[model samples]
Target: MADQRLERLIRQLQRHTVVGLDTAVFIYHFEAHPRYLPLTRVALSRIQQGHQQGVTSTITLMELTVRPCQLGRRAVAYHYEALLVNFPNLLLVEIDRSVARRGAQLRARFRVRPAEALQVAAALTHGASAFLTNDHGLARLNPIIDIIQLDD
Candidate 1:
């Protein structure tokens, strides 16, 4: 029964056509955060179950690349690339003029930091209905978009 209920909830979440991923999600995926693994499984399971629209901005990808460079983990870098390449359900959003303009506007109006604005702009640009993040600042932007914060 518990498994059934969980599956039902996962299906409901997946029914939303678009979902956005924040940088921390990528970090968590790489670093093996205890709580993150299960959620990652849920997300992957959702995607495998036919949830087709998952997205993350180039910024998050860039950020994820940094840790390996900082740690001199070239192998990890390759692993990261492989993960992104193989993940059919995840889409990578690039930084562009429209994204910058919208991000600037969000910064001005919401007083969001530039990084957060870019993140939100990418999500919005991708037509995401939910932005999945572990950042607290996203809660403040909840008025601007749907934010799902992962507190792990």
Candidate 2:
């Protein structure tokens, strides 16, 4: 069953040349969440292997580092920052004016959080064909960009 799920995820990921990774995906991988780590591992491996390109908003860095910083795990936070910045075939997209405008529209229409909207906006603006996330609310964005839910 695990192998089947992993294979299915790989197939889904292969369908997209560029995939946008959400912050939750990274958190799962970082924490090695038992249920979702396999999925995130496959997704990230595809990017690391150069089979597909990965994109994520800079907001992800902030999200990933906050808890660690709060817990006084500065070293861990720095490690995550370094990994994110230097990850292979992954682009950390900056939030710009165009992204901000699109994010505002998504936020208003979809009623998602500001960071979530900006992440999707960055993905769309940067030519991502699919966005990988665990947040079910983001599934509403399928019409805009394919939303690949980890659990599904």
Best by lDDT: 2
Candidate 2 lDDT, 1-152, residue by residue in tens: 88988888888898999999999999999999999999999899899999999999999999999999999999999999999999999999999999999999999988999999999999988899899998999988888888988886
Weakest 10 consecutive residues of candidate 2 by summed lDDT: 143-152
- Stretches of candidate 1 off by over 4 Å are 1-12
lDDT of each: 0.77, 0.93
Task: List the candidates' TM-scores in order.
Answer: 0.85, 0.96
lDDT digits (tens) for residues 1-152 of candidate 1: 54554455465466578887788877886787876656666765666566757888878767888879899998887888778667778888889999999999889988888888998898898888877777887787778677776552
